[model samples]
Target: MGFDEVIPAPGRAWWSPVDQGAFVLDPGTVLHAGPGTERVAHWLRSTVGAATGLLLAEGRGDHGIELGLDPGLGPEAYRLDVTGQGIRVRGGDPAGVFWGAQTLRQLLGPEAFRRAPVDPGRREWPVPLGTVEDRPRFRWRGLMLDVARHFMPKDGVLRYLDLMAAHKLNVLHLHLTDDQGWRIEIRKYPRLTETGSWRSRTKFGHRASPLWEEKPHGGHYTQDDIREIVAYAAERHITVVPEIDIPGHSQAAIAAYPELGNTDVIDTASLTVWDTWGISPNVLAPTDNTLRFYEGVFEELLELFPSEFVHVGGDECPKEQWRQSPVAQARIKELGLADEDGLQAWFIAHFDKWLSARGRRLIGWDEILEGGLAKGAAVSSWRGYAGGIAAARAGHDVVMCPEQHVYLDHRQAPGEDEPVPIGYVRTLEDVYRFEPVPPELTEPEARHVLGTQANVWTEVMEDPARVDYQVFPRLSAFAEVAWSHLPAPREREFIGFQRRMVAHYARLDALGVAYRPHTGPRPWQRRPGVLGRPLEGPPPNR
Candidate 1:
């Protein structure tokens, strides 16, 4: 038998398999067992029944059934061996089990399992044997959800987690704070939720218009809620990395606590959200009281999240406030800083050290690359690939989430058909063609490329349906890019993957997902019908 014949099994097994009769399965054939053995066994029976007349045994084998687990590896290793009287699976993690199941499905063939060889590779049939080792190239393949702009309910978060788990992604970066809203609840500061959580009026569409509805819009996640979410992710082996934008996108917090602002001026009467984002005069105070306020907030966060990485947003902090404020000027003078950028660096260094002491590594947007890069800081390159390149060259671990390729909020094509302002046009083909690690780096420098991420900024994604529409197919493209390695873009292989996506879309529909339709050419639909039709219109919204 060739490598194409076997299927991998799914789920974690504590006991190592005895090398009596084991064979490597095709990487694509596994099926995830999910959570436990009961579920795994149930899926195995049903899936086998559907594909072949074969049915799995109800319980652990009388012949001392055993499976092994390698936590350091990914889910693709599940392997199943069929011979003489019984079948046995090697490796028991849900992912491993799932992959094994996929191989089994393939072995069962397009017809029912009634045709399955009772003794595969007997005197007449040949069984292929080989050793296989597999692992992910990137450690932090992730997706960032900007829920602060538009709150997604708890159920929505779980659904997103399901997708993340299915794709073998490891991290879910929750953008919890922004100028629009403060999404996480702090018991000490009830006003942060009660007042700053909602806005009286919201800006509708890209065009600035007073088409305002009086409905208040906003919500926050309670500590209990976060605990539930964290546990849910852990079971799926996905880490939930929380991002609290500091110093810069802090208008909502300022609204809740006016004392944190530089000036005593209050803006309670302002009903609309801030139109402009970059540097604002009103930033977090650099005073001892301000530091204490943030420390209390982070203390609460540290308790809720168990992830080793915490994102302290150090992007888009303008130097205008530091230049104007007497206190900021005095701090700069006292600290003997060079300029406002130095002050910004000082703020980040402060948090970087603080987070380090608490057993957490600080991850910042690429802007932290400016002024001075902090030691032991991980960089998320969102502005472009240049930032990621810079970080990698400078000896920092980098997650390549360039707005050009990984920003899921951006439109997939150029047209009025898109949901948000077009920033970068990225088709499915374009996404499939992306390489997270830049070729410019040497082998050692390239090793610094941690992984990649798809960011969904919900500013224009007001509804969950729109959210799904933007995320789906593109996310699938990114999933393969993150998990599987291939030579440069092969149009045929990608098209085959797209055919599989059609089936995936049906599954998503059954699950009540509102994904965007795939209107491009099918993977198998290659005739010399059309060539090079240039896409036109605005870029995608990120």
Candidate 2:
């Protein structure tokens, strides 16, 4: 295999056996700095120390390790050259350099991911002889964390960020608000968390047999928590994109502030935090007050996340309330809009204008394309690539997260029971075969396809371990799909990629990730309703 030590296979790389020779890292190794690489050096030292319990010394030297800047390499690209004498890594920017360091850790073997002190007999980590010239194929390699459905703590979020960075994934799209809960702290809206972040009980069990987790469930990240998470992600060159879902998933918010909902049609005073799943008819009323309330929320969001695009959830919005509300109908007539879809479009357009004024672009679910798409709105195509193809054709940016192929919440296999079983089966190969830009899009239209990401909706997932089980291995394949450019569907091969996973899994083990094994689920994991059926043909929703 050509330079087999890396995942998201490098673009250009070569490796050869050097007859019992390797770059052995030990306590005596010296880290030489390049401009803007002090942090990089420190990271390397900390990582090495964590794995081997030996701190590496830093100074100017002929070489132990060297980090250099190479402006010509372009952005998010790097070159790692390993020789018998030492190792040298060059990147176009700090992000590129950080990726290289992550790769270097992989090269050092699985033990490199461990935090345990070094063994008495093992004092060094060896990297094979090789050079890797690498860069990502797509700019928006990302993963979505749905903290709204079932809140994940700040620590878990940070851990997942580390894993994303290890795979060189650049974006962390945090689904922070939904009918189930609102997960971000807004100073002006304390009630949003105090009342909305919690639900009386949870709807659990299969569709045929329903049950409830009678205990109250809730959690929210404070402003300070968000600030720390953002900084941590920034240090690893990962951008945390916060999604404060609105319009449809606003039941929680409406529960906190009754005025935010359609009090004219729905009983706002009786609106409790949504206790179940699926689309909620309790959407944000298309009114000035609701608009002003969200603007204040976005003010806090924009300050927290430096991401250029903010996701305003515009999907699964039931029009029952809109169809019954006089205010919504009046807004549609006032704007000369067609129907409920038009009214929803008008609502999104308001935010589009609002966000644009603040130098940010509006991003929302593909449903935003319903009546009319905003001028600069970006679409996250979850239902399928059809929306993405349409959005690209319409000259708008698109992030292809088709539910069929990229939804990590889906069961890994047809018969395997899962902790959080939902959605149709999406195999590792299915994810590996996913290409962000659809074949139907022309070159010009394809330019609008920024890239793609996998989403982990946590309706059934109750803990970090469950999230780990649902997202991994498949996440690994997806990393390659987003970062490495292989041939089209039938032509692309994954055997080598599979081979590399053998070692990568060890790295994950060291990191204490509870990934599912390739052999399939353990016996305890198998159950009737828990095991999802395979998606043989196009899924009904898709």
Candidate 3:
């Protein structure tokens, strides 16, 4: 009866009387799919069959489930009605049908989450009669993975995609390049992956002020691999937004080809894939070569990722190197720019023009606002909400991922035991309480606020298991914040949501999600790379 029973609590839902009866699914049950919902029906057929050992057929039938498109429904919205006679889902679009399928899976039970060995005879799942009308509160429900910090393999990425899709998050922002490594292959620059992907060692900073592992560490995603990744995410109705960090976090690129940097200012060979943390002063110099290099890189990226938005990191870029370079200074005066910040804008605008030509939108960190953001660029406000507020006021679309709220790397709790020992505490409650559209914005201004995201920076994370522990539960809580409308003063609401998680946690367990236990982290959960202590901020990306 109470809506608190739902995770990501559906926009609207209600229970029906048991006398109304329930639909008993069997091998012979037909999954009738309407136009534009065939793919979703197919997925549902496969999913349900796998979970319960029922060979449900996909076809029109008198007594069975139905997936249909409702022309009147809005974007990513769906309505589900269930009765003993049958169950029916009407969606606004293909995507809406997919979400409806997800909701149906939840309704079916935890068994719907996994493909276990079914008994030979067959099994029947009885679904409770109910009605749910749902739609997302925001279009850009997203989750970001900084694979550049610690290269997550292809399967690892896929697993996250499955998890995200299950939670109804639509965007998977891949931070592909950083000072530590460049994870995507650029055919034009083979060395970007060949040389830039490998580091002589990793800095532990445990034994000494700075320690290095003698072991060489490296990995990369080939063009084919990226293609496969794109196709896989597409099947799940998720968009993969690729990031190629420029200017700043260019140590990897500079390591591959020193000419991309200010060789006039510093020794070119000194630039190696950074092993230690901190922003490297090494950055791509404002030269024809640097511009052409990125153009080539994006040329490859454009072919790989077709998402409307592409992230070109413009955050935490130090201007010291640009100020000192004679070439940089001369170029500044040549362009009639006031300072280094303007030069950085030149870099962003170059790509802005390039992506726009390809009919894609440029997404940059809040720093793109320093000199001036390019005309069509969408701003990702990570530093804080003020950047999003500013960008929205300026009529630019903004994504809210303020570190204080949505950064998952931040310790979930305080004291010595919190791993990744960085960032101030940002708990599940903090994330759930965050509103994507800032209060400072007027109604018109608020429209520019697309949505928000939870960032999982893998600076200290080395494997997929740790990623799960850090992301789940909190991610689950944030999903509700992004999808469901909150009643004013949501404290009591959170308590209700927390209760809902008891069932969700069981679902996660059945699906083999190594979520952090309600108690605390296990000993092995803190692997060699991470410890129980807390970390604040990142190792200098300076």
Highest TM-score scorer: 2
Ranking by TM-score: 2, 3, 1
TM-score of 1: 0.78
lDDT of 3 by residue, 413-518 (tens): 7775765556767677777787777778999999998988888888767678778878877999888888777764345367667778888997798778978776
User: lDDT score, residue 139, model 2?
Assistant: 93
True-structure lDDT of candidate 2: 0.84
**Which sections of candidate 2 miss by over 4 Å?**
18-20, 118-121, 206-208, 419-421, 525-542
lDDT sort, best first? 2, 3, 1
> Where does candidate 3 stray beyond 4 Å?
1-4, 17-20, 118-122, 205-209, 489-492, 524-542
Q: How high is each candidate's TM-score?
A: 0.78, 0.96, 0.95
Estimate the TM-score for candidate 3. 0.95
Global lDDT of model 3? 0.82
RMSD of 2: 2.1
**Candidate 1 lDDT, 452-493, residue by residue in tens:** 998988765768877887887788778778866645664426
Model 2 scores worst on lDDT over the 10 consecutive residues at 533-542
